[model samples]
Target: MRHLTVFDLDGTLVDTPRAIVETFTAAFGALGIAPPDASAIRATIGLPLGQAFGALLGLPADDELVASGVRRYQIHFKEIILPRAPELMFPGVTEGLDELRGLGITLAVATSKVHASADALLRSAGLRDLFALVVGADQVAHPKPHPESGRLILRTLGVPAESAVMVGDTVHDLHMARAAGMRSIAVTYGVHGPRELAEARPTWIADTFDDVVGLLRAAPKGLAG
Candidate 1:
């Protein structure tokens, strides 16, 4: 059966650690606020910008500081870092994606990035054409762990919950998939680690991008129930 595979952008399919760190640092610098430690910043990735800012700053989501910080962060990423940084696709991502497509699986992205920014990044990595749909933070009222984005992707893909999988590198991804009644696959090379991901109970854990391709090829039954 054909599958609808929903992938997360930053950690799962790409290593964007540089862009994330630099942007957050620059934004906080611009605002005269000391940036959170690098590890703390990295840990909160895969969340919405507002939420991430709130967590790092110890403020409410609706606080003006978080809102302003997010805006400044996007500005720095767009105007400064994006032009100079290398493309961020993880090793084997393109080959794995090609193989998964060859297996007749449909691919889409559900990420915390804004639609335009995520599209630009994917295009830079030459992976944009592989996705049937791209769902971004701006497009959804709520981000991952809320299930709205995953539900939207599955609906748009016309794939049943049981016939799809959510591949990502964070607990939010696993929780979102489970809440959507879809299978979840966590990749270790991303932001979070196995110990944390295990708490979310993914259907499977992949060590490399190729392992994801293998999982889809094997099409393990009863995984997405």
Candidate 2:
């Protein structure tokens, strides 16, 4: 049986940390607040938009301030992030995925980013057709750490979670995969890094998307569908 390879967008598939920082800075500046600390904002990369906004702005997730923060962020990211998205696709991501696709593995992209933006970025990066399933924060009823997105992606691919691997850069990804009863591969070269990702105890921990392919290759057979 072919296994599934489910990926997280943003930190895992694209290196948007620098672009995110720029956008967030634009957001805060647009709001006339002292620009947020870059490291703090970057650390919040993998989280859902509301949570990331709230945390960055020190507002409750449902607070009005959060709305404002989101508006500010959207104003900039929607316009700038896509074009100048940080080119952090590591050294081996595209080629790796291409090779994996040639292996007849099922691939999907699950992201905290909105569907439109995720699709655009993937296309802009020349990776549009690589995924059979594209699940985004807006496409699901719930976000990461809530299994819904992962479950949805697996359902779309007609694959059981047990036969899939979720590769991401955060605990949130691990949590969602675990909730969906799938194995998780943590990539450390993103926002969370290795230290923060250790708590998840991923099935494998790789340092780059390039390195992740080797890890998947080494994974038990029938795991990278």
Candidate 3:
């Protein structure tokens, strides 16, 4: 069977906290509301835009204020964040991805970002072509920690859950992988710290992007459990 690897975009493949923080701050300022502190915003990095805004503003996800915030965030993201895509890639990401492909392992992305934004960011960073599929929050009825995104990727890619591993930087990603009956590799360099990630019970914990590549290369098939 062909091995498959599903990755989380933000905090995993891309270092997006700075851009995300700036965009959220800009959006809240546009709404004349004080933005959440950077740490609070960072805590919500792996969630969908509505959920992130809701958590930050203490509003319901479907509230008009949250909707407005989402709109403003998108505008600022496109104007400010997208332009900096090239600088957002994590170290060793490009080389590691190339090495994974060279190993003949299929790769896909499951991100909380909206489909259009995820696609645009990856394309702008020149990493879009590396993925066989990119499933974003908008493409799923429920997002991470719910297993919808992982299941969607597996089903769409025709890869069994056991033949794949989910690599990410947040509890949401690890939980999603477990819920989907797939093994997970948690990277320590992202949103959540090692202690928090350990609570998620990933199959392995990697300290860097190169570590993730090494784990996959060392046990391309066995890592899936």
What order do you get sorting by TM-score, best first? Answer: 3, 1, 2
What TM-score should be assigned to candidate 2? 0.92
- Cα lDDT of model 3 by residue, 120-174, tens digit: 9999888999999999999999999899999998888899988899999999999
Which scores better on TM-score, 1 or 3? 3
TM-score winner: 3
Off by over 4 Å in 2: 220-225
TM-score per candidate:
0.93, 0.92, 0.97
Clashing pairs in 3: none
> What is the alpha-carbon RMSD of candidate 3 to the true structure?
1.0
Instruction: Give per-residue CA lDDT, model 2, range 59-162, as digits (tens).
Output: 78899877887778777776876765436566788899997887777889888887877888888777879889888898888898899999998887788877
C-alpha lDDT (0 to 100) for residue 114 of candidate 2:
79
Ranking, lDDT, top scorer first: 3, 1, 2
Worst window of 10 by summed lDDT in candidate 2: 216-225
Q: Report every candidate's CA lDDT.
A: 0.87, 0.82, 0.93
